[model samples]
Target: MSNNLFKDLVSSVEQAGVEVNHEALQVAKDKLAMKSIIIRVISILGSLLGLGLFIGFIALAASDIFQEAIAFILMGVLFLGGAFALNRSNDGAITVSIAVSLYIIGYAFLSYGLSNDGHLMGYSMFVIALITLFLYNNHIISFLSSLSILVAIHFIMFDLDIQTFYYIYLAIVLAATTYLFWQEQRLRTMDNLIGHRYLPIFAALFTYTLVTGIISSTQQFGYYYFSEFRGVRLFFITVLVAALLFTVHLVLDKMKVSKLPIQIATYLLVIIFNVLVAYYYPAFGIACLFILWGFMRQFKAGFAVGIATLVWAMGMFYYDLGVSLLAKSISLMIVGAMFLAIYYLIQKKGEKHDNI
Candidate 1:
């Protein structure tokens, strides 16, 4: 009886172990099946979205009916498709191809729209390009979109009075594009591309400002024949300032002397020069101050100098109101002292933290 009981106990233990193993295996299989189903579903959905976007993009390029509406639709599809593709694939070639295709389609639609006369298609194209640029993560697409938008703007305002609104618009666009190109070049360490990208943009802005200045002087100020010449002179001065500042920046960057002390010294020197020049030759002083401030690196001293220069410029050029130079001097001294106090406080706090 004892032997029979022990054998039954052993059999029961073996059966229980087998059951647990079977259950675990079944659970793992179920999980795997579930995962496979999910993957298949996602793949199908992605493919379908991609197909739909391709069709929409083609339709926009082919049809001219309500171009802006078509553009919006195309943009929506591309955005969805791009998101899906990026999530689904780690393939660089695929991502680049999709980006290029979307960009080309966007460009085609924009070009067609802008080519049509008497249509606010130019503005529409600009909006579309901006949307495409924002939606797509591809660098190529972003560059192309920016270029297309710029071209569309030029075409739209070809015959219009550029001085009325285009000047500000051009300045903003040029600045933004220049910054973008700068960032890209910095990231890639591509000096050649940087030069190519920024030079034309700078030239365009300089030319526009110069031409507008001339036209405004002649047409509005009744300078008549010399308005054009005056515009040329203004343009040359603007160019000179820009070139000088840019050269200074290049030298500083090459020297790698971007430390706080050097920067502060630069600001001090610039401020002193501007003040002395203003005392001697007040006409060019304000412009010099503005150029210097705009080019200087933004630090504590730089900010102070910028504000002081701006106040002096406004006083000299915009307002004929005379102020007590002593009062101005006192105010600036107080500001400088306050800044020093703050800096000392920050330094003390840092030291205390370091000690702890």
Candidate 2:
């Protein structure tokens, strides 16, 4: 009788375990179904939001102010609503998309006001829009916000002096760029993927500066008819600078040079270039020679040689020496030889240090 009771107890325990397993499986299935439903709902909402924005754009283009305003308001509401919903749902993409949509709507409203001769209202709208955009950690939105602010300042605040406006823009851009660079550096140190992604952005910015500088110089000094054509020259210069900088960075990486040295060389070169461009004096060439000497002392042979070549070329082009063209060519050759000798000496020292 006791043996019969033990068998019955074991059977009961096994049955209970099977029941528990079945319940757990059902719970998992329910959770998965809930997730699927949420995903579908978010997708539908996104589609609707996109459709609404498209209709709003059409209304705007038709110059139906009432319709446009209504559409924009609707768009903003939809995005804000979606963002709120997604935050609760723990859907990152939904949250980000909605936030971006809100920013776009704000920008559109600001633009409309500005174009319609409502400068005060436009400026107010833009300021509000920038604040909203800044709350979101999206780079695209941030850049657009900055650009909108710049445009508003340029067009609406016409009373400000051009130089003042230029300086303000420069300061803003520089601050933003420095922040981004610092972020990139931090991410790189942490081995994050985002660290490398900003390279193209930096390249693009440098290109823009180069292109704009060229166009403005050409238009002001080269007697261009319209300011519109200025951008083309600026664009080419931007391309050239981007290409050169990219190459330099690439080579430095391959050579396993420390980033500090590369950065220092870049800074020195930039300062020398700026001084030369600003002064347009023969003495700048002498200053460049001294800068090159400093770089050589720091074991930046490649950079020193590159700067020396640049100075020599610029001098030859700008200075109309009483001497013949042959004399200029001979002088440049001598300068080139000097650079080669210096580079060789530095290379030998570096080699010896490595050997030891």
Candidate 3:
């Protein structure tokens, strides 16, 4: 009997040892994964910084004695060669760096070759964007290409006084956004695709472009020479179109959830709010969108951006207000209370849903 008891004790000790070993192994693996993620993030930042430095160097060189067409052409060739070499070696960071360098150098050459003619330079930029978009494997390249194309279009529209150009530009942006929404779905479906991992970065860039475009449109800038009535009409029309696009994006995002009706209602309410805010206080509207996006995506970086925008909007709005200090303080208090109440109600609803 004693011998059997001694054997049982030995077995229990061995089991405990095994459990401890398993837990330790899992902890080690978690730490290693965290470290790896940190390293990758650092590497991405380093790559971006390296590309910036390279572009700065090129700019300095071009601004100095290397202002001639031949010099720009040679710079483009040098970057093209580096891109080819990096592509052959399959180095993602260096390849992306070289591609960005090539983009700027190519643009410089285009501007020089076209003698700074706006029309030709604009078209050349589009051609450059298309070429880079098609040839590059990195999503960063796609982002840069899209950005270049957008900038080129904006540059072309700089002196335009036509309502049609504004409409066309907004339409093109909506179409591009729709394409990206679908592309995001495709990326999720093919999770193993090389660009799938970069979807968040792409989404962030797309969001930035959309937000900026909407804000620019709100300003009634050089897009059109409109009378007061026409300006108001065009502004509301643009806001309405943009709100509809945002609704479409939200639908795409929440399509998998079962609460379709509730989601639809919520999205509609949000759209209505956005339109109202944008019509009155455009900066605040942009801030609201950023904050909503951050909350929906659970993205901390987005939250940071949204908070910054919110502060800016608030500062701008209150800066020139004629309200007395007491009134302003009371208004702020009321607003804070409303926010708290809303938060509490939402939390309660979430809890009820979870319980159900």
Candidate 1 weakest lDDT stretch, 10 residues = 218-227
Using TM-score as the yardstick, the better of models 2 and 3 is 3
Give RMSD to native, each candidate. Answer: 21.1, 16.7, 12.0
- Scored by lDDT, model 3 comes in at 0.53
User: What are the TM-scores, per candidate, against the unseen true structure?
Assistant: 0.34, 0.40, 0.59
Question: What TM-score does candidate 1 get on C-alpha atoms?
Answer: 0.34
Kindly list the per-residue Cα lDDT of model 2 for residues 150-249, writing each as its tens digit: 5555445443323323323433443344345435435443434334234334433333332332333332332321224444334333333333344345
Q: What is the lDDT of every predicted structure here?
A: 0.46, 0.45, 0.53
TM-score of candidate 3 versus the correct structure, residues matched by position:
0.59
Pick the lDDT winner. 3
For this target, which candidate reaches the highest TM-score against the unseen true structure?
3
Per-residue alpha-carbon lDDT of candidate 3 for residues 16-98, written as tens digits (9 for 90 to 100)? 87434433443354355445545445655676577668768867876864656666656656665565455445534444455
lDDT for 136 (candidate 3): 57
Q: Which stretches of candidate 2 lie over 4 Å from their true place?
A: 1-53, 56-102, 110-118, 154-165, 179-272, 278-356
